[model samples]
Target: MIGLPAAGDGVVHAVFVALGIAAGIAVFAWEVRRRGLHDDRLWIIAGTCLAFGAIGSRVGTWWQQVDPSANDTLAQWWMDGNRSVLAGLVGAWIGVHVGKLITRYSPSTGDLFAPAVALAIGIGRIGCLLTELPGHPTGGDWGIILTPEHAAALGGPAGVGLHPTYLYEALFQIAAFAVLWRMRDRMRRPGELFVAYVAAYALFRFLVEFARANSTRNRNRA
Candidate 1:
């Protein structure tokens, strides 16, 4: 695995996250405007979703690391913790619904958000590709091969090819965005497109986890 020059000090993740949020919001706003559904309350909903999503991602990461044998302190966990994009999505969904209820807005904004979310996720996963562990061993030469030192740094098998899981996910999200964008206007229901996107993503993520080393940790321990 070769380190990205721009990922110095691990700030690439934060930079990409901010960019993702900005790009998502920009696309969402454009979609809302194009669909003639512009409303100030949507911004509020977006803000709420962002806040909750951040919290949920943190909590999800903490949940994954929860172990009685670990001697890490709360401050350490707070300062340096893992996160889950799936959990963030769940949190954002909840936030949007709660925001809708609070604002008494009834129209389904899912169609307006589907493409934006997909695109943002696609872009964000690039950061993951650059900064995070690649994935499980490939046992073949047809994948990202890491040097012994790099493999050790990422806790992967030394001098082996591994699945570029984040790249796979990024490509999937981009493809999903293209598909959803094309079908956005054809969907009869306002939220059906979003539902389809979420379902597809969930299925994809579940399948990809099988190829992820971290996903097998519990089984390995057992």
Candidate 2:
């Protein structure tokens, strides 16, 4: 039986997430330059999006942790917060529009951001794969089977194959990136590319959530 490794330290996950964010920002800057968008307001928009995205992600995770028994202090929650990618995306979208309204800069920047977001998500999911529970049972050999010790540490069932949900998401993001890259130039509308990417990702995420054991709706399983 193939064995999965134990979850890594929180610090490691944080480092990967930070790296992903930095890489995403770099990519966004590059794309902006390539498109000859020399708007000084772009940086302001990016900063706003980052700030709101962080807050939204943390809030979303905290909301999802609906366990009544888990009585964590506010400081503890802030220090070691869980985050949601979906929430971050939503927050970033809102931030971008709000920033634009504030700066009165009228241009479609979605095409520039779509690929960068996909790349960032793909990189960040690597950390999730390394540190979080895989997902629901796969009921097949073609999945990650965590060792007894590792499973115990993660409070998951041992000696069973589970879906590598994070890996699936990472692969999906990569594919989405490729598709967005190819379709960027073909999009007739300014924001169409980003809209299409977001729609595709939302559908993917919705289907994938069904295979998540930790999903709130799946908690009452036999």
Candidate 3:
């Protein structure tokens, strides 16, 4: 079956995204107050990062679900579906860079967004547990338990114990936040911190993907 085909009823993803951005804004405000980098322009930085992140994630998913090569009509493609997290991050990255061209924004802004995005993703992953068909399997030795029905909802084995990628991502995000917090004082450059953050996350996710049981991207698991 093609699953229930719903994007979670509670809008948890939306809420988490909002909260994560809010948290980032709060942190930015705090840093400005503390470091005396207080500038109205900082708000613009935060806005651009968060806005583009969302836009990127959405676009990536849209691209994945639409098989332009197979689907002929625009409406048919639109009605298809979306992609995975990897795709979303790619989308977010593309969106940020493109937005930079249009607005002439700086890459340094990524530093301000790093922590907030991490925090937001950690929380948002929780929502995925409650909504959407999770990438879980049938009974696990030490894994998540989704009903066969639920698994069917997400194209997975219902009632199996599958890898809790959401939890995995959440844990790594928390770790990323911790690392960023520790590096905050020593960070030499603005964009450097964010670059490190992204690199670290990519590595962490890739490592954890090794144990993932339901993914299709063997070449790039995470």
TM-score of each prediction: 0.86, 0.87, 0.74
lDDT of 2 at 177: 87
Residues 96-191, model 2: lDDT tens digits: 888888898788888888998998888888777776777888988767777766676666777788898888998999899889878878988899
Candidate 3 ranges with C-alpha deviation above 4 Å: 1-7, 64-80, 83-107, 136-140, 212-222
Better candidate number, 2 or 3, judged by TM-score: 2
lDDT of 3 by residue, 1-222 (tens): 122323344456557656766775677676667767656655554555555665445344443435567533545433433425565566556656665666675645666667766776777666564555445452445566656555544555554566666667888887888888777778877778779988988898787666565423211112
By lDDT rank, best first, the candidates go: 2, 1, 3
Write down the RMSD of candidate 1 (Cα, Å). 4.0
lDDT of 1 by residue, 184-221 (tens): 89988779999999999989989998787552211110
